[model samples]
Structures are given as structure tokens and as C-alpha cells.
Target: MINHPLECWLNLRMDRPLNSGSVSPEELQAWQFGLLRKTISHAVKSSPFYSKQLQGVVPDEILSPADLNKLPVTTPEDLRKNPNSFLCVSQDEVARAITLSSSGSSGTPKRLFFTSGDLERTTEFFQYGMGPLVGEGETVLALLPDSRPGGVGNLFAESISRLGAKTVYPEDPSDIPTILNLLLNSRASCLLGPAIHIHALARLWKSKRLPKNQVRSALLCWDLLPPVAIETISNTFGCEIFSHWGMTETCLGGAVECFQGSGMHLREPDFYLEIADPETGLPVPDGTSGEILFTTLSRRAMPLIRYKTGDLGQIISGPCTCGLSMRRLGDVKGRLDTDILLPTSEYLSMAELNEIILQYVGVLDFKVNYQQQSLALNIALDIAPESKIPTDLSRALTSYPKLSRTVLENNLKINIIIDNNDGSISSGFGKRLITSS
Candidate 1:
């Protein structure tokens, strides 16, 4: 008997032969220009925020890339300052109410509304992004906690249901043993979850000793997949790993990779992708890093065009042999503002730096502070002391050149603190891995 549950997905997805994922870059640009124009007009005509901002301005006449910037970049600040005013459509039409965390750098929360169509389009994203990886009747174990009103977990469940896969949702991230047992007995063929949860599972598997096979493919979504987590997953679980990059505000499925293991293939048709100089709001050529911008096309409740995502990445101009025409974003460099300033006249991204340093096991939690030329490391470990970091680490730390000379010349000191988070972990809301005070 075949598991035919995923037939619903076929009906929900595009009927066209998406098998060949490429549209010429020139074609994509033209298509995006039209969508951009439409989306801008929709926002200005419906959303009070845009209408007020576009006062004395016409979105329809705003053609050409140069005129696009004249509209202005809408920030989280704009939305929080006024939520009801940002409504693009009336309340009766809205089918769902989705609340999202504030995109602000600090405290306070923001709630946004989504119509039924808004939720459906988000689910459709999975058909293109993960449909290639998951086929009819496959079982997918979602390590994500199931919830709605906007989150990766709920959207993931919706996507899996569309693809006709069984979703064994874990109640929480800390519930490792219960989740592992379900995966063992339930015959889940594929796995998808936050990388941290998977990494924590890898740690538990090693400590408790459990069966590793049972999984055919795994997807790392929601958060950055640390390099260490990738190797541990492939080596221990022996399953293929595909990196997922998206934001809850943008919906769950923005991009995904095929089994080919190539770079992430963005979902371009649903949203326009952009990398621009943050300060100038001008497009940067492919391969040069800049802030990411997204424009939602199908959304009617809260349409956002050229909305700043706060994330940083660049496009992959070269072709992807995976046959996906949707553009690719470079292995993301975290938030544009999440920078560490070293006293050595250089800025550092703790996320980028730890992507290199967290290769070893037991480096459970780490925080790097480079203030006033001082590079201090706060590490939480399950094993391996400072002595195990290799004498070269000190020298390698010095190799930063500018930061190194200052430290060696008695201008600054590097502090390494080994604090055990006591195995506590969190997703979305709290601080973990790399964080600022």
C-alpha cells in the first residue's frame, strides 16, 4: 500500500513543470519588477502606513529601480508605532490572527495579522522548497514544537501535511528522550527542526547510545546551522542535511536545498530577494554582502514591499547545478547590527567568528566580546578545558593581526569563561549560542 496522503500537496502546489527550477536571471528581474510595482501599489492603496507615507506620491507611476528607493524603507519601528494603521484590508476578510515577536533590537513585542490566504501561501512555499526533498507518503519527524499564530513549527506542520507526510511533533525542545523514542518506534523517514535541537539530540545520542539510522533526510531550519552541528549530523545520523533560511515574519519556507546538497534555492516567485548596502539602501552586485530585503506578493492583509529583513546575505550569480532557478543567498551573516567592535579598529560578527571556532565537541555555549580591542571568549563546555584548545588557539587568536598586536602589547586582554548553561536550551525567544549582554 502506498501512502497517498500527499496528493493534497499536488493540488495545492503549482501545476507547471517546476522540475526545471531555473528562470533566466533577466526573466526573473522582469517578473520581479512587475511584482514590485503591483506590491507597492497594493501597499500604498490599502495600508494606512504606506498611504500616509506615499501622500502626494503615486505608487503606480513609480517605475524603474531608482524610483523604488523614493518609497522609503519601512522599519519594525514603523509597524510597532502603529499596527492597526498598517492594515491593508478590513477585519472581516482576515481569516487568521498571527502574532510575531518584535523585530526590535531590545524589549517589547509586536503582533501582526494574516488572512487565511496569507497562511495558505506560506504552506504553498513548502511545495517548492521542500517538495523536492520530501515525496508522497514519507514520514517526517518534526523536532519543532507545534504552535500557530506564526512560527516555524506551525508552518512546518502545515507544509508537511500538504506534502502528505505524518508529523510527529515534539512538545518542546528539552524533551529529548521522549522525542528520540518516538523517532525510533514511529518509522519517521525524514527529520526537520531547529539545528540546536538536533545538535542537542546528537549529544544525547552519544551520551545515552541509540540507534542512528531510520532517517533518510534532515532539514536544518529557523536558526543558523553551526558547522559543528552539520558534521556531527552527517557523521552520527548519516542523513543528508539541507540548510533552511527564513524568518517567521516572512513565513517559514523562503528557501531550501535539494538532495544535491547544493546551496539554498530561494523561493523567488513568492518573494523578491535583495541585498543592498544598509546605509545607502542601494542594491549591491551579486557576491557582495549587504542587508536582505523581502517583498511579499500574495499577502493582502499586511503587504510589505522592499521590507528590510534585518538579515545580511548576497546572491549567488553563478548557476546552481541543482536545476533550481530561484536565486541563492550566501551562507547568511547574521543581523546587520549584530556586530562586535574590536579595539583594534576592526568590527567582528560574533556569529561569523564562532562559525569557525565552534568545531570541537563540548563547546556547548560561547559568547565573544570584542570591545575596545579586547577579544574575550565566554565558553560553556561539556568537556575539554582551555588547555585542550591547542597552544595554536592563543597564537591563532593572535593571528587576527590587528586585534592580536593590541593584546600582546598589553593594550587588551582576552577572557575565556567556561560556564555550563546546565544543558538548558531555547528556541526563537531566548538567548543561546552567540548573544550580546
Candidate 2:
């Protein structure tokens, strides 16, 4: 059997030859600890935030991964308050800076800086991560933004070229019709974009009765992969489905799902990940669900130590079915803050709403508003729907386990508004949220 592409890339990054053997977890952990110490020294001496945060702390004391728990964990608020204080390198050395808006009512946005070398590492990771899905001479239809020089889509396109593959992008990534035409015209074998946009395209394709000729695989990133989206895309396109988990702080490329489909392997050499109890901020045992935290091991512009990712996941214990020893992240759920509690003591999240609503054939996208015990949904369909669309959606949602109890006990009113004549509902990127008004 062929080795996992990421495993081979890890060996090469460590200066070991490819196809030799898998890098032992022990060896990788030791390498990470050494790098972590260096990162600590570098950040303490340069970065204002770390210098103040790590005052009276000694870098040499951090001899192993366990020592990381002793240090302070960074939060998104810290970055938003004073982003410049986190910069280790001079402003002249900063290659790119990405500003992420806060999901809540707060207007402050977190800014991340990256040096040229930092971007190179992410590009290198993308090159190897996509090895199993696309290769030389194959065309990849990248449905991500590429206008910025050091943007995620740009780096991904660069990685495709490095792998000797061709890349094509839609004129407007938000336009589903343009993307479908390009996918057919370019004869691209792989699709890479957010889950909702791809699902919309699949719905349109199915509505048009187009054949799934060239699309062999799809790489879903930048958003949650609701099970309904996966099933719809798979059934409509007859293509393999691949999921990726990453965020802006992670340089937009964290973990990629290998062919085995068990879980997503970490970018071990570049990052040290931890599963921590969200409430206590303490590390959890393997196979136990907790908040995802990661420390940068190879960062130069800005080194983050024990940064909270705001996402929940677990580490799958034992070797992968593909025979590699690298730790894999299990299914990651929604952010901790996304869940809303009802009077009936039931929880509802955008993920659950997505799983229930997107399953409908005509539904393209939906925006949710939950406030004062009233749940209102504005759903966008591919085409004009029958009069029964709203009623059908409401009945289906009330049947969901998470919402059933609340709906029955509280007499919850779920108002569904269907829009079939409008264009696409969402931009097809970024995290989805439930607005309270």
C-alpha cells in the first residue's frame, strides 16, 4: 500500500528520505519540544505580548510537551485587543496580515501576521496534503478567493502547480452558475471550496440533469461539512468526498483527511496540538472530547503558544488503518459559543440546523434568527418551490432530537420563510452563525 502523503512529507521535512518509513511519534514529539523551547525564547525576547505574558518564565524549563500546560493559553480576545504586540518580527519583515472579524456583536477583529517563510510552510503543506487527491496534469477547480497575493487560495493554487497540476478559478467564487460552467469546461478532476457552495452547485447540477463526468474528488474546507451536504454532493456528483479543518490563525491549512477516511492527520512538524477541557483549560485524555488548542512549532513572524481554537474535537488513539502512527483529530463539532440553550433545557446549534435544513432538495442556503424563544429561518431554494415548502421544512425540523423536546414542551414557534426567486443566499465562505435580534 502507498504511504499517506502527509507522512511522507513529514519525513522529508525532518530531512529523512521519502518511502523509507514512517516517522515515529516519539521522534516527532522530541523535535517539537526542541522547537517549542526555541520558539519560547524567540517570542519572549521579541514579541511584546509574549514578553509580558511569559515574564519570569524560563524557556529551558519547557523540556517536553507536558511543560506546555504550565504556560498561559492565548485567546482570540488577546489577539483582538493588541495584535501588534504579538508580532515578533519587524513590520518590514511581515509578508501578509489577515484580519478576522469577531462573530459576536463585538466589532473588534483579530489580526494575524505572517512572514514570507511562514507562508512557504503552509504552501509546502498544501502541496503534500493534496497529493492523494490530485497529481501531475490534472486540473483542480479552486472555488476560493485568489485576489490577494498571499491568500489561502493563492497558496493552494501555487501548491497545485508545485505538484505539476493545473488550477482554474471561477470569475466570481460566489456565483454558482459560473463555477459549474468552469468545472465542466475545465474538465477539472477535483473541487476545493466551502461545503454550502458546493452543495448549491450539486443541487443546480442535479436540477439541470448534467452528467458528473470530470469531477473525481472534492475537497471541502473553510466551513462545516454537514452530513446532508456530503450525502447530496456524493450522490449527485459520484465523486469522493474529502474534508479539511483549519482557520485563519492556522494559516488556513491545518489537517487534511487521508484516503482511509478514519480522521484528519495533524501537521505535526509545524504544530503541537492539545485537547483541553474547555471549562478548566486542562488537557484531556486521548479519545476524550475537548477544546482544540495548538502551539506553533515552526512559526517565525508570530509564534502562538497554547492558542485556543474555540472548536471541540478529540484525538483518535492508536495507529491509523493506513499504518501510520501520527495523531489524528476526530470529528470536530461547532464552536463552543455557537450552541444556544432553550427554556426546555435543550441545545441548538447552526450545525444541527444545517444538517436538518440542507437535506431538502430545493434548499440552497438559509439564515437563522433565534430570539426571545422564537426561531425564524430564511431559506433559499434553487428554484421556485411549491406552497408546501415552508410547511415541509418546519415539520422536518421539529422532528430533530435536539429541537423536538424544546418544541413540544415550550410550544416553540418556528417560522420558515422560503425564497426561490432570489440569487444565492450566502457568500459560500466563512463560518455560519445564528443571529439573535
Candidate 3:
């Protein structure tokens, strides 16, 4: 492989190939297929679940996007019904066990096992993915949720320690105020956590005149980040902010954003990524939005092939300014389940709702639940004591049209619950439950 100076720089920052500023699309595709074949063959042989599923089938049978459909999609139910079936190693070989819920209200919890090698791979991803947006000797306070024994957080804590970064979790709501002070004086170079928790910190900084850029960067995940919030965070932190994509079932990440600011690069070497039709299991053309379908490339204890991520994104094949041979995803559009349908026949997604609420800046947090037939939109939010609802804000709803039309064209109503805290919002988990019945 030719060592372009730019390529070397990106490689140093990222463990996987990226849009390193001048990667050829053809070369990238070839690299993808080669890695895909090897990962599939290895998983099928070692993973108990995959071995039984692919029994009597040739690894070559999964030749293309279409051929993948011939194999059944993996569901959490399969794991719950027979958890041990996914094991690829014997009892003596298994090094760790982690239990996690799929985040689905109806899904059961799952246990995933990892050998030392799996942890090593995840550790490398952190060094490569988060390292670029970061500088050495900076302290990172992990706002990420504590994944108690055998959960994702435990792994993240281990990873953070490996990165030579210190971690801080509020652990209790009472600690938030104290956490705020530590961030101020700790001269902490980084703050890493979910968008909601980190955003609350930004609001606190906005009001308290806390030191900015004394912090190096913020690593955010777990919820849809509103564009307005991103701008506000960068301004308040006075430093770079980066985000990576991950899923509980897929072992942390599907991709990570680069310093280029173009889009997140798919960790193609670690996972076989494809955008597929949710109903038909067929590949969507590059650059078109569809469900994200993934196959684990780096797996030992458990390997999932052609797993439906339930996340939507676009695949880019054209040239990238940052330049790595691997593919880049246009964006991860949140869960397919976030969409809510009204009797007026309009559809609303959590992303759209977040954009609307954050635009006001007057709001801090809220709980939303749809009413029968969508006659009313009830919004619970924190607002200012002196401020009152602006009629124009209601009018802006139609700008998005489909959702706004329910109130505009139909008899639908909007009831906003604003508990104005003078700009301070409560800290909690699970997306603030914007929509509830």
C-alpha cells in the first residue's frame, strides 16, 4: 500500500481505513469484500448460532446484497430463546459475560460474551475513533451511563482507562451540582457522555460562566442530537465536539466521525455494513436512505451475520475530501420505531420533534405522548417564568408540513407543558421520553 502523508495521518488517528483525503472507490470496494468474506467464514465456523444457521451452506452462498436475504435476519428473540447458541467458544475460553437490553420496550435482555481479543478490538476503536478529535494529556469525564457488571459502561470504563483518560459518572442526581464544579476546576480537557447529560452541562456553563476550551472536546452518543444543540455545545465548550455510532447488540460502534466533518466513516473492516429495504432485505442504492443492515466482522464468542440494525442511513461511494478507501455513512437517522402516526395520517419522528423543541432555546426538557387519533400534541418542557408561548412558534410547525399539517389543516391541537426553570432542565435517561401516551 502506498503511504500518502495524509493517509498516514488519518490511519494513525483511526484504527480502520477512512476517507483519508484521496481514497479510490474501486480499491475501497475490493478491500470491503475481502474483509467481508474472511469475517463471514470465521463467524460461521466458530459461532454456535451462526454455525447451526449456516449448516450445509457455503460461505460463498452469501455472495452479494441479494444473496444475504437467503439467510434469515437475526432478532433479539432468537438470542433470548437460546442464548448459549451464539457462543463461539467453550467455557474455559470465555473470558467475560455482559448482559444488556435491546432498548425495545418489549424485548428481553441478552447476554453477550467477549474474549480478551474482543475487548482489545474495542479499545483500539476508541484510540483511533476518539483520538483524533482529542489531544493527549487531557482528562475525559465519562458522562456515559454506568453499564454495571457485564454491561457496556464497564467496557467503556476499561476503554477510557486504556486511553489514559479519567472518568466521572454522576451516579446520583444529587452529584450533578458537584459534577458541575469538578468539570470547572478539574481543568478537565474532555467531557464524554450522552447528548442529554452533556447538553445540560452546556446550559449550566452558559449560565455560570464556566471555563470553556479549558475543555478539549466532548464525545456524545445515545440520542438524537439537535443541530441547534451542537452549535450551542461547541460555543459553550469552546472546543471540538465529536460523535460516534453504536448499538447495544452490535458491541458499541458501527462507525465514527472524522476531523474532516464530512460524515462518519463506517468501520467496514470490523463490520459488514449495508443499507437494505426494511421489508424486502434488498440493498438500497448508495446515497439513498434505508435501514442499516450489519454483519459483525470482528467476532469470537458471538457473531451476527446480516443483522438488521433498525437504524437508517445513506452509503456514500463517491470521493471524500478526507480520503480513506472505506465507505462513509451520510448519517444515522435514529430508530425506525421513533416514527409516530396520527389519525390525520401524518408521521412524526423523534428527530423532527427534537429540532422543533431545541429551536426555541427557551425549552430545556419535555415528555411527549401522542393522544388517540392525534387530536392533540402534549409537550412537557422547562420554560422561563417571564416568557409565554409564542403563537408564531406554533405557526412554524407547518414548515415541516406533514406533522404540522395535523394542527394546521385538521382540528388537531397543541398543548405545551413548560416548567420554566430559568433555562435549567432535569437530568434523566432514555431520551427524555418526548412522546408518551
Query: Judged by TM-score, which candidate is best?
Result: 2
Whole-model lDDT, model 3: 0.65
Q: All candidates' lDDT scores?
A: 0.64, 0.81, 0.65
Number of the top lDDT candidate: 2
| Model 3: how far residue 229 lies from native, Å | 1.3
lDDT of 2 by residue, 178-207 (tens): 777888888898988898888888887887
State which candidate, 2 or 3, has the greater TM-score. Answer: 2
> Candidate 2 overall Cα lDDT vs. reference?
0.81
Candidates sorted by TM-score, best first: 2, 3, 1
Clash count, one per candidate: 5, 0, 16
Candidate 1 vs candidate 3: the lDDT winner is 3
Listed in order, each prediction's TM-score against the native is 0.82, 0.94, 0.83
User: Which lDDT tens digits does candidate 1 get at residues 272-292?
Assistant: 777889888898888898988
Q: Model 1 clash pairs? A: 6-164, 21-325, 22-325, 343-372, 343-373
List, residue by residue over 1-437, the lDDT tens digit for candidate 3.
53333344335433455434444555554555565667667767777777778776666656565566666678667777777888877877776776666556767777777777776666666655665555555666776544565555666656666656655555543244456777866677777766766665676676667767587677777666667677777888887777767765566755666652567777665677888877766788888888887877667767777777677788875756555555778766676767777766767776777777766644545567677565777766665334556456666655667756666668677777665455445645445444546
